[model samples]
Target: MCSCQQHSGTANSTSAPKDAISFRVEDMTCGHCAGTIKKAIEGQLPGSAVTADPASKLVSVVGAADFSAIKSIVTGAGYTPSPDRVS
Candidate 1:
């Protein structure tokens, strides 16, 4: 299966939350990487709002989807999640 197909299997069916959750992404090195991460997360969690700052390597996600599952998506996209930033 392709990477996209593999990722589709991990997609979440839950609804997004009202408040946003912030996380520090250590592997987002450029604009393209940031965009890719944003798309990956939003695709996995429908209704989610994702904002990523490549300079600070911070990704804030607002949704009701499972955080652990989201983290897995980040890892699969080649980014490291900062444990301290997770709530």
Candidate 2:
């Protein structure tokens, strides 16, 4: 299912400017998967903050990378980017 859920938060040092976009990954299945996705995103966008909840199959990414690029990173890390959860 493809869906976009918007979240609001402050900009910390780990995140980009206030206008930076965030994406919710709904396909992450485990800690290792989360780690891989996090690494991939961070590798592409340094200091990117990724938080994953395996129980909810949800992953939140805060960085400067565009949605498409972030989706690619997740896919490259071997996880499917849920169309319903990417912002």
TM-score of every prediction relative to native: 0.72, 0.63
For 1-87, candidate 1 gives per-residue lDDT tens digits of 022321212222223244767777776666666678888999988988787766666777886447788788888887787876544
Off by over 4 Å in 1: 1-18
Local accuracy of candidate 2 as per-residue lDDT tens digits, 1-87 = 212233322222333334555455556555555566667788888877766655456566665547778777778777787765433
Maximum-lDDT candidate = 1
Quote model 2's TM-score: 0.63
Tell me the RMSD of model 2 versus the true structure.
Answer: 8.5
- Best of the candidates, TM-score: 1
What stretches of model 2 exceed 4 Å from their correct place?
A: 1-27
- CA lDDT of 58 in candidate 2? 58
Checking candidate 2 for backbone clashes, the offending pairs are: 2-83, 2-84, 3-84
lDDT of 1: 0.68
Which 10 consecutive residues of model 2 have the lowest summed lDDT?
Answer: 2-11
